[model samples]
Target: MIVLGVNLKKIFNNHFQKYIFLYFLVIVFLMIGISTGAITIRTVDDTAREQIINYLGSFSSIISKDADLNTIKVFRYSITNNIQTIIAIWLLGITVIGVPIVLIIIALRGFIIGFTVAFFIKEFKIKGLTLSLLYLLPQNVFLIFGFIVTSVISILFSISILKNRINVIRRPSFLNRFVNYTITMFIISIIIIIGSLVESFTTPIFLKVINNYLTVFMK
Candidate 1:
């Protein structure tokens, strides 16, 4: 356990700079997309808020107005399948094309968060802030850290491998590049799983708070 802790601390210390930069990039992209979306929405209608609420209603309807347990089971399976499909694609690139693939995955993840947050904020006004804080803020904290670490480790492995700094791949060594990537991905996967569980449990509570508080305030 002590050895594991020491290794983890070393890994985190090594990647700290990259992690900070990645977070800043994510925040900047989020702000830009949100500002653009807000400007676009302003040009459409003065009753932009009503339109947003309508859209939210529609979206929520799709989620809640479902069938029984069997339908929910299928829906859950579909979601799992989609996530698995994405992971498989990324893995394919990791093994074939190498480290650039991980960087691409990081960029794509950031873009999705930025776009989604921007969309919600434009549509729901202040409620978007509440909902996002309740939903995304916690999960994103975990995700960004996990992704940045994974990305850094991938890059490090690739660079060392390419430069022949790490001949352990062809020879017997304590830390092979492929083994490092696998371990890094495994750790990141756990963070993602925990984040998902937190989101699943916490979001509904936050949503209820918004429903109750905002419903009274808007009246």
Candidate 2:
């Protein structure tokens, strides 16, 4: 019994180490994507620049205004988007081809964030940086964290399934694990919803305050 316990402990430790390594590897990929995005922003052509600026401008206009937003609507949208991504990851993990797809999703997330930040910094200079930090970073931080966690869990489960196919371990019951994964995703989605509320309600107020400060300071 003691020996069996020791073996299980060793297996858990090994898996934990692998998870850590995979997490950091994903982080590196994300950072690389971010750097690439920043470089892309710097090297785009005149027409491309115009389009990018216009695209970012639409988002900027939202927070720059002093009007009230439909908070419930924003919350619903945020929750829906988050839950969709989570479900996609969960479903993909059941397939052998999902590993690359999951990685691509992670990279795409990083790229969008990186590009937005770079665009802001390039267009508004220091003020753009301030705006990105204040208006963009808060909600994205939560979303990104949730993405990483869900992706890691998906990849781990996928790998485990592969191992079971090769007879490395007996096939374990999946229902309980799936339920736990679903519950975890629900909790993470809630965190994301809170972030959406902040973005919709608190972020505009923050941007307004910062804009006023910058205006007075410049004067």
> In model 2, which residue pairs have backbone atoms overlapping below 3 Å?
none
| Candidate 1 residue-wise lDDT, 1-39, digit = tens | 999999988977766755676545544544554455445
> For model 1, which pairs clash?
none
Best by lDDT: 2
Worst 10-residue stretch by lDDT in candidate 2? 210-219
The alpha-carbon deviation from the true structure for residue 165 of candidate 1, after best TM-score superposition, in angstroms, is 9.3
lDDT of 1 at 146: 58
TM-score of 2: 0.76
Kindly report which residue stretches of model 1 are placed more than 4 angstroms away from their true locations once superposed. 1-7, 14-58, 67-96, 165-175, 203-219
Cα RMSDs of all predictions?
5.8, 6.2
Candidate 2, residue 70: CA error in Å?
A: 2.9
Tens digit per residue, CA lDDT, model 2, 1-219: 999999988975885586897888777777877888788797888899777545534544565563654566566776787778888988887776897788888887788888878976876789779878877888877777778767877887778778777884576767776677667666656666666766666554654555564445435
Query: After superposing candidate 2, which stretches have Cα over 4 Å from the reference?
Result: 1-18, 56-68, 202-219
